[model samples]
Target: MAYLGVDIGTSSSKGVLVDASGTVIATAVRAHTVSRPRPGHVEMDPEVWWREFRDITRELLSGHLGGPDAKGGAGPASGASGGSSPTGVGVGRPGPVAAVGISGMGPCVALADGASRPLRPAVLYGVDTRAVAQIARLDAELGRPAVLDRCGSVLSTQAVGPKVAWVAEHEPEVFAAARRLFMPSSFLVHRLTGAYVLDHHAASQSVPFYDTGAEDWYRPWVDAVWPHMELPELRWPGDRAGTVTAKAAAATGLAPGTPVLTGTVDAWAEAVSVGATRPGDLMLMYGTTMFLIATVTRQLRVPELWSTVGAYSGTRSLAGGMATSGAVTEWLRGLFGAADRAVLLAEAEQSGVGARGLAMLPYFAGERTPIADPDARGVIAGLTLEHTRGDLYRAALEATAHGVRHNVEAMRRAGAAIERVVAVGGGTRGGLWTRIVSDVTGLPQDIPTVTVGAAYGAARLAAAHLEGEAATAAWNPVRDRCVPDPAAGAAYDGLHRLYRELYPATRDTVHALARLRREAAGTEDAASGGAPS
Candidate 1:
């Protein structure tokens, strides 16, 4: 039998079909972009996710069945299969789908009406910093010390509590009509199985709304924030959410009674993709943003970092994220008019460790974890006319490396035993970024065979639910490791010290600039005769 796994990401939606033996049989992707109507407001219509999921599933199934006409055009189970296709026409039959799994970028806020229809574009996680005022107000009202003790995290742009508060205060009409909250994963589950459920791991990230100690929604806090809204029933990441309904089966071409597993956020799913869930294991995901998840034996609280429930039950994690990582690289590529990544990567490699006396702060989208400064702006120091795009690109890589080091130190300080670092995502395709991170942090990184990321992880979770533990391990394995160089590590030690000091030195000035930009945006919106876009 085969399993289907799909992940709705910030940039694209991907689907993978894997067999019982843990081999990928078919894969498909649909690229999409987010809406940046105003600065610091990243969002996307929920309708886009469903459309892409339908498209990717059809493409993957068509590839597996040899053509769209196979099995009387019922479609090849889409994201549900593994290994090479069996040698025969009967292999295209529709009954091979054993289980379905899904995941998405989350801790997002998608307020829905009673019928589960989205009221507005989903406000994305952490990267959307429009809730700064709400974060401060919530922290003050809830008591910072109490929030840290109960919720396991401080109120920042990352928290769902403040985002909900922002909606209630700013858009009272929409807030009044909202009845249910959904993230990408839960939204998909609701559509497919007619079940309104959320995974515990995702719930933990909804700071002040969920109590990590109790492993359930903190009702008192929920009442204080959004009293009228009803919460989804909580389930573990691997638990079965519900069976697919006939209506959903007709839309997606899957069997009507197929089981669908409740899934968690993309980072945790990425961690599961490479078996990085053990105690002391850390998963460093390099994508649009840089995310670190360090699996720990117990829940440890640090204001600088996020402490949350792990993908599995009875485990904990200390997580940190940079607002931007590969995004900075992409920005440079656009500015330099380069069509491919190889050109930029090759140039950065030749520019060497120091980037020819250039230093950069990768805060182009403000800062997350360890700093939590939503007003922070990107800064480039020590630039001269002699410096080329190569030097600037190298400095950007180094800056992200320094940010990783800063997060690692914070995790260690909070008692997370980071024994092994597993690196995954599109950024790991080129060796330079991984090597730079290792040299800077003095840590070794293990690269897995399948870096397809969260989609693959969702498949694994599906396999585990149907065939048990053995099915998960056979799917992905560590293929290589990047070890630290002693000399390069020494050089980075001094540079990291400077990186730490640079932020504080320029904070006040950067904050002033951020205020000015917001003022200008407000005026423009007022002139346009609407709210801040």
Candidate 2:
């Protein structure tokens, strides 16, 4: 039987069907964007996630549910399977689904009522910096050392607790009725099986609410943050959450009583997709926002980086994420009105090394990890009037590379041994961005065969659930490696020094501007923005 995997991402929802042998039978994606209500406030309607999920699932499983052996060249519509195999039959034919895996962009705060109805729009992850004040207040209230010891990381914009506090303090009406908490993955799982559970990796990002050392929720801290809220049960990313219910089956076409595996954040799932589970293994996800997940031997705690339970039980991770990677590039693409992304990439390549002596800081959505500054704004330095769009685009690419190097240095300082880097996600599709990152960091990245990302990883996990540990062992293999050019590396080392200095040099001005914007806020139009989620 084939496994079904679905991931609700920031910009879209993607679904995949994979056979027991790890061959991708079919893949599907539904494109959408997040909402920017006000400055630093990024949100999305929870219903949109479920709606897109339903659409993607039906599309993946579409075809006549007939006998596989009785088929007379049964291939119809738009789906994945055709040939008959021992594990699964092709799409239009009767291919029994073995299990389901779910993942999403997290650790988001999707507050719901007792009945699991979302009270308001789900507040996004680190990129949404509306809870800066709450972060400071919580750090003071809980004590920084106590928090770091319990949570394995200090309070920051990425912490779910602070965002929940923001809602309690600001939107009291919604907070008053909220009794259940859900991130994207947990929300989807709950909808599927009525299982009130979340994976340990996502739970750890809730900061004060989760005790990393104990590997469970710290009830006292949870009560302190938002009184009387019922938290979901915690499990490993691959653990079986529950069987799909009849209602959920009817809504999504997934078989009733089918097992649904617990899933963590999207980045972690993508990391799993490339088999980056061993210590010293780092997974670089090149998506809307670049994510770096370094699997470490032990939990490396530092204020600059996030230390959370890895996707699996025995493993641990020290991770860092850029606030905006492709997001900045996409914004620039929109401004330039470049009809095709390939054209922009080609232009950026022609612009070359230093982007015609221009430099950029890709903090359009504010910085996360290492610098963790929400007020940080995007900057373009040394831009002359004659600088072309190609030059600006090249600078943006280099800027992300610089940011990545900064995070890598922080991970090293935290004692993470990053030996092998596996690159995954949509950004890896273009060689130019990966080349720039390799040159900037001086680290070789292993690119896998199936880069469809989280959904594929989810499918792998589901395969493991059915066939035991051996099922996921030989899945996605590395096909190519992006190595650094020593000549380009030497030049980037010098430019990176300048990139680091640029942020601190302009922080004060950006903070002042950010404050002014907040003071003068309130807009009727909700702008649909950001790269991919």
Which regions of candidate 2 deviate over 4 angstroms?
63-94, 522-533
Per-prediction TM-score, please?
A: 0.93, 0.93
lDDT of each: 0.86, 0.85
> Which RMSD does model 1 reach against the true structure?
4.8
Worst ten in a row by lDDT for model 2: 524-533
Q: In model 1, what is the error at residue 91, expressed in angstroms?
A: 12
Kindly list the per-residue Cα lDDT of model 2 for residues 407-498, writing each as its tens digit: 99999988999899999999998799999999999999999999989999998888888898676888988899999999999999999999
Instruction: Give the CA lDDT, 0 to 100, for residue 25 in model 2.
Output: 80
Compared with the true structure, the alpha-carbon lDDT of candidate 1 equals 0.86
Model 2: colliding residue pairs = 1-87, 10-533, 11-533, 81-90, 81-91, 82-90
Per-residue alpha-carbon lDDT of candidate 1 for residues 1-533, written as tens digits (9 for 90 to 100):
77888999887788887777767777776667889888778898898887666656555556563334344333543332222222211134333678888999988999999999999999999888888878777878999999999999998888999898988987899999998999999999988899999999999999989999999999999999999878899999999999989988766767789899999899999999999999999999999899999999999998999999999999999999999998899899988986478888898999998899888999998899899988788999999999998899999999999999999999999999989999999889989999999999999999999898998899899989988877577668789999999999999899888889899998888877877787778822211111111
Which residue pairs of candidate 1 clash?
17-81, 18-81, 18-82, 19-82
Indicate the TM-score of model 1. Answer: 0.93
